[model samples]
Target: MRVINFAHGDMMVWGMYLAWLLATRLGIDPYLGFVGCAAALFVVGLVVQRGLVDRIVDAPHEMQILLMLGVALVLENGALLAFGPEPQRVRSALTLSTFWLGPLFVDVARLVTFAVAVALSLALYLFLFGTDLGRTIRAAADNAYGALVIGADVRRVYAVAFGIGAACVGAAGALVSPFLPFQPSAGLAASVTSFNIVIIGGMGSLLGAFVGGLLVSVAESLGAVFLAPSLKELVSFSLLILILLFRPAGLFGRRAG
Candidate 1:
C-alpha cells in the first residue's frame, strides 16, 4: 500500500479524530459515531471525487498532488472556522484497566480497536472483490484508457473508490474518538500515519494497507511500552526507514505507481 498509496498516516489520524470527537461530545457510542462519520465521509468523498478529483483523473501525478493539497487546505480551514483552534476530545468509557496476562498488560480498548479495524478491513475487501462493480473498479484502476475503450465507466469508478477511501478515514475517526484529543489540524498527523502504512505495505493494494496498519500499530504499541512513550513517531519512522532500506518495494509488494 505504501508503494502505491501516498499519505495513509494522515488518513488514519484524521478519521480517528473525527470519531473521537463525535462520540465524546454528542453522547453517542464510538461505533455509532464511526458509522455516522463513515456515511458522512462517503457523501463527502462522492462530492470531492465527482466535483473535483474526477475532473483531473487524467492529470499528471504531480498535478494531482497539487490538487489534493488545495483540497486539504480547504478542509483544514473549514475545520478551523467551524471547530476553532483548540484541541478537542470526546468521552469514551475506555480506561487503563488492564488485565495482567502472565507478564503482559493488555488494554481492552486496544483489543477492541484492533478487532474493529480487522472487521472494517474485511468489509472493504469484500466490497472491492465481491461484485460486478468491483471488477469494473479494478479495471478502471488498472488502466483508464483501456477501461474507457472497453466501455467501463471510469469516472464513476473513480468516484466510488475515492469515496470508499475517504469514508474509511471517517470511520477511523469515529472509532477511537473516545480515547484521544483532536483538533482540525490533526489531519496532518493522520496523513503522515497513512503515508507510512501505504509505503510500508505497498501501493494500490488494500491487503497491503491492512497489513501496514497492523504492523505499524504493533510497532507503535511496542515503542510506547518499551521506549519513551513520547518517541512513538520517532520509532515508527525508524521502522519505516529500515523497511525501505531492506525492501523498498514494501512488505507485501513489488512495483510502484
Candidate 2:
C-alpha cells in the first residue's frame, strides 16, 4: 500500500508537475494542470480495475505476479516514451515548513497527509462497522466461500473492494502529487512501500491499515531526522520484520493460514 501510494503520487503528481511546468513555462496557471492530471488518474485507476484486475482475480498467485510484472513493463516503457526517461519534480505545496501543534512540531505536508489518511481510515472503519455494504465486504474478505454461500455475490464484492483499494491509492496519489517529484518508473518503489505498510498493519484488517500507516509515517519521519533519509525504507521493513517475528499475526490481525 505504501509503495502504491508512492507510485500513485509519483505518476499523478510527477505527471502533473511536468504538465504544469511545461504549460506554466509557456504561461499558464498550474492549478488547471493539477486538476487535469488528477482526473486523468482517477479515471485510469477505475479503468485499470475494469480492464486488468477483472481478468486476474481467479488466477494463481504466480500468474498474478506475471500479469503485474507485464503491466509494469508496459506502463514503464509507455511512460518513458510519453514522458521521456528523465526524473522531474515540481515546486511542492508540501514544503519543509514546521507547524507548532500543542507541544509538537509537525511538517505541514506530512501533517496534512496524516490527517487525510486518518480521515480515510475512519471513514473505512465506519463503512465496515456502520454500513451493510461494509459488513458484506468484511464477510467476503474473511471468507469468500461463506459469503457466496450466504448469497452475498462474492465476485461483485471482490470487484468493488479491489476497486476501492485501488481507488484509495488513486486519491492518495492526487494528494501527494503536489508534494513530491516523480519519475516514470517510480511505481516499483511505491509498490514496495505499499507492501511494507500492508505487512506491518496485518493483512485483512482496516483498522490495522490506519494504525500501520500512522506508525510507518512516524517512523519514517523520525528516522529521516536522525538517520539517513535513504534508510527510511530499510527502517520500515526492518521494523516490520521484528514485529512479524514476534507477533506473526500482525499487531492486530487474527491468525490465519
Candidate 3:
C-alpha cells in the first residue's frame, strides 16, 4: 500500500495488549483471542484512517510520515500510561511445548505461529487477487486520480486497505503472544526488522516481503548460532544495507517507469 503508516508497530502492540487483557481478565486463551484482536485492530484502523490518514493522503510524503510518526508516539505513550511500563506475558499450553522432527526440534508455539502467518498471507493474497474489494483497493493504490475518474470510491478503498493492514498486524500479534513478551514498546523491537524485510523484498509485493522475511530469519539464525549471538541483528542490518546499495528497488520490486 502507498499509505505510509509509521504507527503500524504500535498498532501491533495494541493488539497484543488487548489480547492480553482478554486472556488475563476474561480467562480466555490467548490463542483464541486472535479473532477479538483482529476485530479490534480493524476498527481502530478504520478510525485512524478516517480521522488522521485520510487528511494526509494527498499531502507530501514528508507530511504523511510526520503525521504517522506523531500517531505512533501517541499510541506508545498511551500504552505506557494505561498498562504501565511493565512487561506482560500471555500463558498458553503451547508456550513450553516442543515438537521433534527426527534430529530437529521446534517450539510448538513458534511453529504454530509460522503456520498461521503463512495461512493468513495466503488468505490475504487470495482476497487481493480474487475479490472485488481487493481490486478496488489495487486500483486506488495504482492511480488514485484515475480511480476517482472511474467513479471508484477512493476514500472507502483507502479505509478498507488500512483496516486490512491493521488486522494483519493484530493477527501477527496474536500468533506471537504465546512466546513474545507484551509491553508498550515490544512491537517497536520489530519495527526496524519489518522495514528491512519490506525494503529487501520490494515494497508493495507480498511475495517479496515473504521471501525477504525468510531470508532474514535464516540469516539471523545462522549468525546467532555460528557467529556471536550479539551479532545476529548486525547480520541482518548488513544485509539490508547491501540490498539498499545494490538493489534499491528491492530484489522483487520493479522500478517505477
Candidate 4:
C-alpha cells in the first residue's frame, strides 16, 4: 500500500478510453459508464499487484520506482497503439447544461463531478473505517508482519487495496472524460499533477491528499484567472516548491521519525 504508483495516470487513461468506448458503442454516458470502468481497472490493479508488485514488495525503493515507471511507459505506449495519438473527450448531455446559483453560473457536469467525488470520498472513508476488511487493511498497513502472524492474508489485502485505489482512479478518469480532452501523452501531465498533490498534501496521509487536491485545484483556477491559462501549471509547481520548502512533511502529514 505504501508503494508509489507511477503508472496510476496511465491506468486512468485506460479508464477514460474504456468510458469512451462504452459511450460511442453502447451509448452509455461517461457518468453512467464509470462503474464499469472502475470495475475493469480494479481487475487491472489486482493483476498488476499480484503478478508484478508482489514479487518486488521488499526490493529497494529505486527498484520499485523503476518498476512502476516501466509499467507507466508500457501502458502509455499501449494506449497510443490502441487509441492513437489524437485527444479524445467523452460526450454527455450534462456537459451542455448549466445552472445559476446566487451570482455564480456553474456547469452541471462539474457540479455532478464534485458531488460524485465527495460521495466517493465519503464512501472510501466509511469503507476504511467502518468495515472489517477496512480494519484489516489498516492493520496490515500499520504492521504487515503482525497481520501475517495473525493469519491475515496480507498479500490479498495489499492486492485489494491496490485494486480499490485503481478503481478510484478509473472512476475519476471517467468523471472527467466529459470535460478533459485526453490522449496517451496526457498521462505524464496527470501523473505530475498527482505527484504534486500527494507531495503537497504529504505522503501516507489521506486527509492531506484530499486537502492538497483542493488547494492545488484552487491555486490552478486562480492562476488561470489572473495569469495566462497556459501558466496555471506554473502556479501549481510554484506552490509545490513553497510547500516543499516550508513543510516538506505536508501540512497534515506527521513528521517521520
Best-fitting candidate, measured by lDDT?
Answer: 4
Using TM-score as the measure, name the better of candidate 3 and candidate 4. 4
Whichever of 2 and 4 has more TM-score, that candidate is 4
* Candidate no. 3 TM-score: 0.95
Q: Mind giving the per-residue lDDT tens digits that candidate 3 earns over 1-257?
A: 37667788888888888888888898777678888899999998999998998897778888888988898889999999999999887887788999799999989989888988899899999999999999888788777899999999888888889999899898788778888887898656666678788888988888998999999989999999999899999999999999888999888987731
Runs of candidate 1 exceeding 4 Å displacement? 1-26, 93-104
* Model 2 per-residue lDDT tens digits across residues 1-257: 11122234234434454454545575433333444544555555556556776676676666666666666667666767777777665444454667898999877765665576667667868987899888998888777778988999765666566556655664565455445666777767776676677678887777777778778878987888889898777778888899788977677788833
Instruction: Estimate candidate 2's RMSD in Å.
Output: 4.4
Error of 4 at 234 (Å): 1.7
Number of residue pairs clashing in candidate 3, backbone atoms closer than 3 angstroms, sequence gap of 3 or more or interchain: 0
Best by TM-score: 4
After TM-score superposition, the amount by which residue 105's alpha carbon in candidate 4 deviates from its true location, in angstroms, is 1.4
Where does model 3 exceed 4 Å of error? none
Candidate 4 global CA lDDT score: 0.92
